[model samples]
Target chain A: MDEFGIIATYFAPLAGDGAFGLKDDAALLPARPGQDLVITTDTITEGVDFFAFDPSADIARKALRVNLSDLAAKGAAPAHYLLNLSLPHTITPDWLAGFAAGLAQDQQEFGISLLGGDTGATDGPLTIAVTAFGFVPQGKMVRRNGARIGDAVYVTGTIGDSGGGLAIFKREKHTLNDADRNALIARYRVPQPPVGFAEGLRAIAHASVDVSDGLIADLGHVASASGVRLVVEGERVPLSQPLRTLWGDHALSRAVAAGDDYQIAFTAPPGLEGPFTQIGRVEAGEGVGLIVDGKAVNVARPGYRHF
Target chain B: MDEFGIIATYFAPLAGDGAFGLKDDAALLPARPGQDLVITTDTITEGVDFFAFDPSADIARKALRVNLSDLAAKGAAPAHYLLNLSLPHTITPDWLAGFAAGLAQDQQEFGISLLGGDTGATDGPLTIAVTAFGFVPQGKMVRRNGARIGDAVYVTGTIGDSGGGLAIFKREKHTLNDADRNALIARYRVPQPPVGFAEGLRAIAHASVDVSDGLIADLGHVASASGVRLVVEGERVPLSQPLRTLWGDHALSRAVAAGDDYQIAFTAPPGLEGPFTQIGRVEAGEGVGLIVDGKAVNVARPGYRHF
Candidate 1:
């Protein structure tokens, strides 16, 4: 089939009611009264964002979930998404079928649907750019610049699992059992985006950001944006048992500097630590500081910085 | 400098008031009451969409203008856009500077601004996906499935200039003056999207589509979606002076069947022809028919289709 045939056979069904059956030049999304729309776009390229050999379905899920994580950090409900896929001639029907299936699963899981998109051929590796939209109450979005002095910094779930998974996939030496290794790889392949508590975080978090680029690095963004400093008790950060066992005293530092955690790192009043692990405090200064054994330590590597 | 530095230096300043200084994970766009947001996305790849040797600024302009053309076809006002740029290691700071400058110029000309976007590295070709947002009165978007029998079919501007220009770029034999040759090449490089009359089209056009995938193919989409046939007068299709003089009768067919025109083809009541040229009329059958010299003809190659 040609591009239109492929879209009609596989992708058209993923579109929502607003997509005009993928026939119109653009899709219609009616604005709700007293609501604000949040928009974010991310592109994943083979060998850079994901291993070229990774399953197509997992790659599709990862692409969508990463954007969803951004919306979660902003305290919005997933609404819809637009997909721009650039495929190589080597792409097969099975790969496209699996990719579409993955998007369908995520749509059901995340409460969003495909809005509209464009597909084109490329001579390079497969690439997909997803632009996702979410909705929040007017003026109620969680921001990255609201942290104040004395606010307690918190993180949801354990960090470093996805990064560790990548390490494992690269065949780095780690003393993890089979089950742990599989779990780590799964975390890296498909993130469990913290979508359940997005609304709650929006209501309570003084500042929030998703841990896409590493804990210390993302918190540095919060610190820089809020014009404050963050003092993180490195040992207090949650790490997977296997990661901790394998890295020991190095686990916290590694987790704080590794990317792809996809967890929520936020700050709130000390009394409002409802479901997150308190790991630090906001201070009146600049930059991020890590405390290990009650002593401030410098981080040589802040996080992944793509150029 | 890294990715964040690149964004802060070249792209952040282009973001509009709702972009949160390009610091947040997502940008906020508050919807107006009784308005609907129209969304469209297009991905342009290096070498595939444009010559790799083309100017970076022109490439950026082309990428954004293509999506803008879609919104114009939908009869929506350009609002904002998100850019997802994948750069290879070979990209230079000069290229980034020129690209951003191009975007700045268009933002002012089109009355839109950058919202938020993502930047990442790609080992392959440079690829950009632009997701644009626009606004129209609630439920007032001009779609491609509303054409009625006996409705006058109209088209704005001339068709096949861009495609012909591309052929000219490849050193194809064409007997044209230098001024006309440059004009054709310029049309291929930077599309002059007919955006000023979008609202007028919304009020009058029963159905409309941008001539991107050639006239016949895009019009076929309208016919299929509307469940009606179109009888187009081949000689009535407007052609640029140079194209007409160079190819004559062959020019009409080639121009009508070639892609990258970026002109608007619409259907409306005969009394509402306005400024657009009447090219044909809608009929009660299915598919598109082209009449050449009083004889119905078949389009052997109906535009560009990517598989």
Candidate 2:
């Protein structure tokens, strides 16, 4: 199909109210009375982000979810997204259908809709860039530079599962059952961001960042931005049971340094918490420190580097 | 440099308010009391959009201006943008610096700022996606489906210069002077979208679109959406002196069927005076028709197609 035909057949139906049926040059975003718009964009490429053998639906979901995760970290409720796809001639109608299907399902699940986007052909590998829009109460966006001294550090959900899943795909030998294997793979494919915690997070957290470039690296960002040090009790950093079984002793280090966790790592005062684990404390210093048992553990590689 | 280093060194300086020095996961866009936001996104690839030898600054500006063109066509004032860059390993710090310089220059000239973005490594060619945000008075954005029978059609600036420039690059021999050759080449590398005409366009136009995919094809879009036919006096379609000198008698046809003009085409009442030329009229029919002298003209290829 041509560009117009592909859009009409698979994407136009996914467009929402402001998109003008994807027929206009631009889309309108109506102003909300007391809300500020939150915007974030991320691009995922074939091979670098996902294998060509990966399910087309999952690839679409991953691209959208990555941006959604950013909005969630900033305490915003996602409302719409723009998807720019650079496709190769090798892409099939079935792949496009599956990709659109994934976006449709996620739109319903996340209460968001397609706004407007551009699609083009490229000789390069397929690339998908998603720019997401969301809303937070005026002046209520939780910032990474708000972490203060003496604040308690917390993180939502487990970390390192996605990294572990990636390792398995890289030919890491594992004596595991199919369920555990598939579960880890699923975590790598589709992120389960704590989007539901956005409102509550804004209400309590002094500072926030999503665990994308590993738990330690993301915390380091909060530390540098807030000008405060983060001290994590390495054992308290949560790891999935399957990941633990996969790597045993070395899982802690790998998990803390790995990327694509997509969990929220934040800081707030002590003694008030829900749906998160207290893993560390913010101090009047700089950088992040990982303490395992009674000694400081060294992290050779902090996170994923795109250079 | 790593992704963080690259962002901190090159992109952070270009960030404006609500961007948080490019440190936050997402950026904030404050709500304007009486205005609605207009959003549009477009992606340009390395080999497809420009030659590899094109100036880095021009490439950056081209990537940005394409989306800016869409906003202008919708009668909106450009405000902010999100950039997603997929860079290959071959990129250098000097190239990045030049690219950032281009963005900085346009951000000043167009009164827009970088909000936030993502940079990732790509195994393929360099790809840039820009999502621009603009504002229009509430419910006042120009639509493609608003044209009516008896409305007069108008277009701003000249058409086909960019396409003629592309032809020169593709080794189409020309006898034009050096200055003229350079002018056409400049049009291909950098677009001057009629941004200042946006407010006036909203006030007068019933339906509008930017002339990107050739005048005929883009006008065809308005015709199909508005359910009215557009009849154009072929000679009235403006062509630059440089392009006319290059293509001679064939210039008019080529101008009407070439893409990337970045000029605004709109419909309004007959005899309305403005900075645009009267080129055609809306009729009680469908599609677009071109008339040269007393005979109808045929367009073999309507516009540039991605697939």
Candidate 3:
């Protein structure tokens, strides 16, 4: 099908009120009385982000969820998104259908809707860019530079599961059972961001950041921006059971350096309770440090580098 | 340079207040008391959108202005944008500098700022996706479905100049002077959308659309959505002096069917005064039609198509 045909057949139905049924060039977002809009954009490429053999539905979900993770870290409630897709000629109608289905499923689950988007042809590998919009109360967006001295560092969910999944795809030999294997793979394919915790995080956290890069590298961003030092207790870093079984003793090291965790790593005053683990504390100095046992672990390569 | 380095060097300086110095994953846009946000996105691929030999600055501007045109057509004031870029390994640092310079220049001209974006490595051609945010008074955004019967069709600026430019790049024989040739090429490379006219157009237009696809194709969207017929006088379609020199008598036909004009086209009450030309009228019918010298002109191909 042509671009118009593809949009009409698979995407128009997914568009919501402000999208004008995907017939207009722009979409309208009505102003909220006391809310500030949080906007984030991310683009995922074919080989770099996902294998060509991966399900189209999963690919679509990954593109959306990655941006959603950013909003969650910023304490925003996602409301709408725009999708831009550059497809190679090899893409089939079935693939487009599956991709739209993925978006539809996520929109229903997350309470977000499609606003508007652009679709074009490219000779390159398929690329999907999603721009998401969310809302937070005015002046309440949790920022990276807000971390203060004495603030306790915490992280939501587990870290390194997605990295472990990628390792398995890269031919890592493991005796993991099918369920465990599938769980890890699913984590890589579709991120389960703590979107429900956005309001709470904004209310309590002194500073916040999503762990997209390695835990060390992302915490370093918070540290540099806030001008405070973040020291992590290495053993306190959460790792999935399947990932623990896969890597055993070396899991912590790998997890600390591996990227694509998509979990919120934040800081707040001590003695708080929530669905997070207290992993470290902020200090007066700068930079991020990880303590394993009695010595500091040397991080040669902090995270993935795109060049 | 790595992705982070590239961002810090070239993009961070372009960020504005809500961007948080590009340290955060997401950007915040504080709400305007009585304005509704208008959002639009467009992706441009290397070969499809522009020749690789084109200046990187021009490519960057083109990527931004196309989306800006959509907002202008919707009568929204441009405010901020998110940029997503997938670069091949062959890109040089100089090219990136030029690209950022291009964005910097346009950001100043359009009164917009960079928010946050993603950069990734791709083995394929360069692809840029820009999501622009703009604002209009609450419930005042012109819609494609608001065209009324008996409304007059009007278009801002001349048409087919960009198409003429593309033809020249494709080695189409033309005896035009260097200045004229350069003028056409410039229009193709960087669109000068009628942004300043947005407020006035929104106040007057019954329905509006930007001419990206051929005039017939884009107007057809308005007709289909608004359930009316748009009739264009072929001779009345605006043609630039340089385009007239290039295509002679054939310019009108080519101009009406050419895409990428990035000009606003709207339907409003007859006898209205403005900087736009009255090209046609809306009728109680469906689809779009072209009339030339009292006879109907058949258009086999309506506009540019990507598949």
Using Cα atoms, each model's DockQ against the true complex is: 0.86, 0.89, 0.90
Q: What is the C-alpha local distance difference test score of each model?
A: 0.89, 0.92, 0.92
Model 3 segments more than 4 A misplaced: none
lDDT of 2 at B70: 95
Q: Could you estimate the TM-score for every candidate?
A: 0.98, 0.99, 0.98
lDDT (Cα, tens digit) per residue for candidate 2, span B155-262: 999999999889999889667799999999999999989999999999999999998899999999999999999999998888899999999999999888889988
Give interface RMSD, per candidate: 1.0, 0.8, 0.7
Q: Chain A only: give the TM-score of model 2.
A: 0.98
Clash pairs detected, candidate 3: none
Docking class of 1: high
Predicted model with the maximum DockQ? 3
TM-score (0 to 1) of chain B, per candidate?
0.97, 0.98, 0.98
The DockQ-based CAPRI class assigned to model 3 is high
Top-down DockQ ranking = 3, 2, 1
**Tens-digit lDDT string for candidate 3 (B106-131):** 99999999988889999999999999
